[model samples]
Target: MGKEFRNQLMKVQKQFPQIIKEVRGKGLLNAVELNSKALSPISAYDVCLKLKDRGILAKPTHDTIIRLTPPLSMSSEDLQEAPKALHALLEHDLPEMKKQKPETVSGTVPNVCDRCGRNLYG
Candidate 1:
C-alpha cells in the first residue's frame, strides 16, 4: 500500500506537471507542493479548503503545501480514493495552465505566502 500510494502521488505530480512542484513521501505518508508560480499559483489553503469540501482531511504545513497522512491501517480503497480527490482539486485549472507553459520541465511550486496569496518562495 505504501509503494502504491507513493506512486499515485508521483503520478499526480506528473498529471498536473505545471501545478505540482514536488511529490515526496516514505509511503502513503506524503507531502505535496502546489506550484504557486507556474501560472495559477494555487494556495495551499485553497487546496485544503477544496479538500475539506471533498471530505478529505489534510493540512497546509507551509505555504503552497499539503500533507497526506492518513492512518497506517487505512484500506486500499481509501488509498486509491485519495489521489483522485486531490486530482479533482486541481482539475479545473491545470489543463489551461499546462497549455500556457513553454518549458517541458513545466512550471509549478508553492508555499502559502502572505494572506494576499503570494508564493512564499518569491
Candidate 2:
C-alpha cells in the first residue's frame, strides 16, 4: 500500500516537474519536496492549507517538504486520495498562487496540527 501511494505521488511529481522536486519515503511515511525556486513566494505551508481544503491533511517541514504519514489501517482507496488531491491542486490552483504578490501570501510559519487541525504553536 505504501509503495502504491508513493508511485501515485511520483506520477504527480512527473506531471509537475517544476513544482515538485521529489517524492520519497519508506513504508507509510513519505515526503514531497517542492521546488522552492519554482514556488517562489508560495511556501509549503500555503500548499498544506490548500491540501486541507481538499480534505487532505499534510504537514509542511523545512518550508519546502510536505510530510505524508497515513494511518496503517488506511485503505488503498483512502491512500489514493492524497495524490489525487495534490495533482488537482498543482494543476488548477498553483498557477493562481504563482500570480499573487508576495505581500499577499502568508509569511508566518504554520502552527496548526496537520492531523487534528488544532493550533499547536499558540
Candidate 3:
C-alpha cells in the first residue's frame, strides 16, 4: 500500500473514533468499518465519493465498509492525495446514514461432505 494513503487513513481514524470502528487490509486494498451496523454502507459510499473528488477513486463493500483499493504500484505523491478527501467525507457526509434494521434471508447454504450424500448439518 502507498504510504500516503495509509497516513491519510490513520489521520481519519484519529479524528473519528465513534464512526470508524476498524481498519484492515494490506497494500492498497483496505477497509474502514463503522462502529455500528446501522452506519456502514451509506457512510462507506460517502467516503468513496469524497475520495473520488480528490482523484483517489475507491469503492464500498459489505455495505458498511469502505474499500481503498488503489493500484498496487502507487507512488508517494499519488498516495498523499487521500487524507483531505477522507477528512471531508468524515466531517460532512457521515451524519446522513439511515438506520439499518434487522432482516433475514431464507434458504440454507448446503454444506455437503465431499464423499457423503448428506448435508453437513443433517
Candidate number achieving the greatest lDDT relative to the actual structure:
2
RMSD of each: 6.6, 5.2, 7.8
Q: Is 2 or 3 the stronger prediction by lDDT?
A: 2
Q: For model 1, how does the per-residue alpha-carbon lDDT over 24-119 read when each residue is reduced to its tens digit? A: 878667888877675344457767766877878888876577888888898988877778888886786445544554442335543654565766
Off by over 4 Å in 3: 1-4, 37-41, 95-122
Give the alpha carbon lDDT tens digit for every residue of 27-118 in model 3: 67777776644454454655566567767777766346777787767677666666667777667655543333233343544467433455
Task: Put down candidate 2 lDDT per residue, 10-64, tens digits, no spaces.
Answer: 9999999998999999999999999987887777899999999999999999669
State in Å the error of residue 99, model 1. 17
Pick the winner on TM-score between candidates 1 and 3: 1
- Residue-level lDDT for 41 in candidate 3: 40
Which residue pairs of candidate 2 clash?
A: none
Model 2 accuracy (lDDT, Cα) = 0.89
- The worst-scoring run of ten residues by lDDT in candidate 2 lies at 101-110
